[model samples]
Target: MKFQNIFVLFFAVSMFFSTQNIAAQSDEVVINEIMYKSLKAFDTNDWIELYNPSDADLNISGWLLKDDKDTRHFAFPANTIIKKRDFLVIIESKNKFTNVHPGIENYVGSFTFGFGTDDMVRIYNSNLQIVDSVNYKSKSPWYPETDSLGPSLELISHELDNSKAQSWRPSYVMHGTPGRPNSATHTEDEGIDDMLLNVFPNPAISSINIEFDTQVDGDLLIEVYDVLGNKVKTILENYMQSGYYNSYWDGLDESGNPTPTGIYFIKVKSPNGILNTKIVKSN
Candidate 1:
């Protein structure tokens, strides 16, 4: 082969790889959460949260966030940086958003939803290239309950496919955790044991059921905390065999008596991370 032809082939190969690298970089920023329908009186502003899943800082300045119908549009600020694994919240109205969350100033407001419950949101880079697009509806796949309820639909894993409804879930709290990690965000740190705790009959009249799954063998600790962060009950503290297990809390504290009403937190500490959920006790 001629040297000139070889050089031409090399140049073309490098350009192809360069374009692929740019496309991958643009896709690192993902749509992390959406609050199309909000129910909180104090937080009436609907918002969408973006996340940088890549290890490098992503400059999303001048990027376009628009709905499929071209109704809602948002152009990001110049040189806006989404740090590595960080979150940026773009809201519909700044006044309503800041009115509720004053400390979180990392929000871009002044955009309104142009379509109804079912619509698509697209994110495009400065060169008008598609980064990511999410088509969300008020039906299956997406959380249907969040369509009218207070909680927002939060992406479970940005590393997962966002176009699927199974990738999202209704936030555990109302209005969602804007400008922060989603309530359903799972810890992917593999250094520790992975665990999940589920408590049913939250507003229990007498007893409650606690089920948990463990991925690693470790000392498992189960405790109950009041809304004030006071340790109310110690359910278990033993070296557990990893897999799946169940425990019961008869609405009793460490003293073997009934607990009070209101809200209580069930905390399960494992090697992976801490698992927390709420259970309401009523008389």
Candidate 2:
């Protein structure tokens, strides 16, 4: 009986320590999204996103993000409160991305560090203790296109791991849903690739055609923006069924005036996802 009591006590102690270790492993604020490459050009803008999983706010003040080599380290400002279940986006270039995703400007912070195709990102607390880390990849099973002109790699769910390749997915949006909900954080298995878009006659003289194929149905907002990021026109803003669709732009602005010949972006957004591509209008 004494042996039994001792065994029970030992087991209880072991369980307590195990639970404490598990709790320490789980981060309240985790790395949720990584946009290491920008569409149209790889060197455009890069960013990382963090999400607070806890019900209460997590103060990431003085948190440092460093690479595996420890060569680069970017620190967060003091009193950086990532609201409960909210996201914090750190971009490499605020000026470059603000034009595209003006909506997320308020949540944006600037970082000058670079995250390699296959690299380690470690987050340390104010005490310089490791909070969380993820070593991402640029190979298959991880979506290689994200290293080039593809979507940003987003964590599917906070329940999943931030370090695993399967836990990450490509952002359907051009730059990414930085400072906002991630595209991969969906319960449905239907992914961002359910819809595909292709723009031809990129540098068209008069008119340009935007064609896309969809495997799912949802409401979408399609708009055209010039090089200056001005909303020249809105092509479509309504529900669309699963099928191939086309949007024709006749080189005209919203006021029915001729638009100047320049580079423009075509953005197609839906509750499920978003897609963006560039087109050039030449005289």
Best model number under TM-score: 1
Per-residue lDDT tens digits of candidate 1, residues 1-283?
Answer: 6999999999999998754423234668899988887765665567888998777677787888988865457898876778778898888888887876778877776675643479887898888788888899988656565665566788888888999998887776566788888877752232234776678886788888999888788899888877445799898999988798989888888888878775676777887677667566778
TM-score of each predicted structure versus truth: 0.62, 0.57
Per-residue lDDT for 113 in model 2? 76
lDDT of 2 by residue, 31-133 (tens): 8888776666534477788888776657777878887767688888866777777888877787777777777753546777777888887888878888878
**Least well predicted 10-residue stretch by lDDT in candidate 2:** 18-27
- Error at 208, model 2, angstroms: 26
What is candidate 2's CA lDDT for residue 248?
Answer: 88
